[model samples]
Target: MTPHDYLNIGAAVWLFVCWVGYARFARKRARTDHCLASVLHVYRKTWMIEMLSRQNRIADTALIASLERNVSFLASTSILIIAGFVTIMASIDKVYITITALPFANESMSPRQLQLKIVLLLMIYVYAFFTLTWAMRQYGFCSILLGAAPAHDADIGEAERRRYAISTAKIIDQAGHSYNYGLRAYYFSLAILPWFFNTWFFIVAVGVVVGVLYRREFHSTTLRALVRDLTATEAMKKSPNG
Candidate 1:
């Protein structure tokens, strides 16, 4: 209704656009480029290849179990956070009073406005919960695939084994991607917190959050290292003896 309201809405839209747009861009680049996700994907494929060559797979199973446990823990945490948001929504009057008393918080938020803000937080956590649960399920599928994998001494052809390894590795990679999405939701939720203070602060928070994500995803030191490592590996493969 007001300029501040329009700015708040604009900030929210911008946050959503950045979140979804970056995810798509990263996914595309990860197929052939050197970034964190792409590097990790290469490792996943290598892990599967190693598993195919190993006679003992206990350690491999343990590693997959550990990944599943991590996803489960995050899913549980998201549920708890959603419940906390609901609690806050139920006691929004007290929350509004407390927040308005803070020196920097906007004092003009009506009950409806407060409720909307709380709902936004709740929705973000809900989305995170679903993403994490889906990741957990994918990890479960990975475990199943691992269990069904042919042993190193099996009579299966090498080509078949390699295919199985690549398929399983892709599944695991997807699970990791889903987990990353859930974590991104948590990051953006933090950006939404400043909206309760002022629209301008909310916009600034959105920019800061997106900037942080962009830098980490595309320009971090870790990415550079991965690129260098990948390049060296490719060079080695092209050598006469390789």
Candidate 2:
């Protein structure tokens, strides 16, 4: 293999490491840190608890439906993207010509190399489709759980009510996690698009993607606002004004 081949291999490996490593890092940090996932989990629990007081659960179910719709939209869009990629696959010759003309890629770029890059993107979208659809189904399951929950005026014990709310919120949280994973795949996929032009560009893009993800997940303004709001809510709950 040539030096260019080695660079390609190294870049691909870097992408794999960044994608998997960042996912693991983010998840572990979320357990002990104040990221969007962890902070929103508290909000989900509070939402479920609030549902316990409403005699009509239409609003609760409606919220669940809205979440499901977002996942469904992404899943369907993934299918369309996959289809477009498939169509592109049928015209690999044109892709090879176009990519080879790029100053960075040049005439030495093999058709197989171009095909592999496209396939990598296709695989990402396929993985995203599966993850998004599963999340959509999980949201549906949350709705069922909500439906079976005790009525507002039921004789259920406090302990049981609390347990039920916790379980329902857990389902919603997990579904949100799955949705996040799907979005992560999409982010990484964007990094790969540069590979056909330059391997080093691809590697740098992967690092940039990781950086963006970390900042958004852990240090975004939205996260700060959510954390602040949650803190105030907890402080209010502990006050003795009542």
Candidate 3:
């Protein structure tokens, strides 16, 4: 293999490592840290438990439907993107010429190499489509779980009610996680766009993507506000007479 081929392999490896590594780090850190996922997980549990107190659950079901719609939209978009990639794969020569024509014209890689990059992007979107669809299905399951919950006035024990609510929330949490993975696919796919230019550009773009994801997930303004609100609510719940 040429040096450029080796660089391509190394860059691809770096992309996956950064992507997967950040996922693992976030998963572990979320157990103790205040990130979007953790904060949202807490809200999910609270929402599920609170839902048991309402005689009518129209609002709860509507909320689940909203989540399902969002996932469905992304899944549909992923299909369109995957189809675009497939079309591009069959016409790499034109793409190759277009890339090389640019002034900064990239690594002199052949059309075969460009096709490989496109295939990688296709695989990413395909994974995104599957994850998004799975998230939509999970949301559907959550709706059913809500429907099957014990009625508000049912004589269930407090412990049993809590147990059921927590378990149901776990389903929603899994759905949210699947949806997050789908989004991560979209983020990393942008990293591949720079690959058509050169491996160095590709590597740097991957880092940029990872950095952007890390900031939004852990340090964004929204996360701060959520954590603050949740903290205040928890404090209120523990106060005397609360």
Candidate 4:
């Protein structure tokens, strides 16, 4: 087989593998009961109660820990995603996808088809680059929030303490959401770009992979589930009243 054919095969196989891994993780998590559920247990009323109860240290710790974990997850996933995009872009230049491999791909098309393929690829690259760049920015925000933490404070009600905690939590959550949105954008490219090679079926493959990933995250009965829940809660807090 040609290098191009091999690359297509590799992409398909790797995507399938990722899908399986995610599915398994989700299924396993869904079957357990764990503390991770607390992550999603956020209620503004509850937050206020914690604040009023003088348990500011506990609440603050939870918020900070959750933010750290979310940032870690995003950073790791962004690396994997950027790697995937780089591989695909490299393959686009080195390997020619076969018409037989992609039933929709026209091997003997006119110059216009080639031009369209070039344009489609450029679009994909542009989108992927932008999303990855945004992920990097969110990572930076996480770093900033981490640095802003008080060096030595064991109490709440100090004006700066309260303000810093609330502001930091909001910033971290916003950065986390941006990271997630950027990832979603990156995945959207995986689904959209293969069509240029007439392998739209790859889109289905990516969907399966993403669904598995999401299920593993939101359905996992452990800390992962908590992570997802807390993430959602954070998003809700940022949303305008409706």
TM-score per model over all chains: 0.93, 0.97, 0.96, 0.44
Query: Which number leads on TM-score?
Result: 2
The TM-score of candidate 2 is: 0.97
lDDT (Cα, tens digit) per residue for candidate 1, span 1-242: 98766766777788788878878877887676567887888889989998999999999999999999998998999999999988998899998899998889887777778888889889998999999999999999999998999989999998999899999999999999999999899899999888888877877887798789878987899888877887898789899988
Q: Candidate 1: how large is its RMSD?
A: 1.8
Higher lDDT: candidate 1 or 2? 2
Question: What TM-score quantifies how close candidate 3 is to the native fold?
Answer: 0.96
Give lDDT for model 1.
0.88
lDDT score for residue 121 of model 4: 43
Clashes in model 1: which pairs?
A: none
Query: Candidate 3 lDDT, tens digit per residue, 1-242?
Result: 88778888999899999999999999998888899999998999999899999899999999999999999999999999989988887888888888888877675878888888888999999999999999999999999999899999999999999999999999999999999999999999988877776689889999999999999999999999999999999999999978
Candidate 4, clashing residue pairs? 4-95, 26-216, 29-221
State the weakest 10-residue window (summed lDDT) of model 1: 3-12
List the pairs of residues colliding in candidate 3: none
How does model 4 score by TM-score? 0.44
RMSD list, candidates in order: 1.8, 1.2, 1.2, 11.6
Once fitted onto the true fold, the runs of candidate 4 whose alpha carbons sit more than 4 angstroms away are: 1-111, 154-160, 193-224, 227-242
Backbone clashes (count) for model 4:
3
Using TM-score, rank the candidates from best to worst: 2, 3, 1, 4
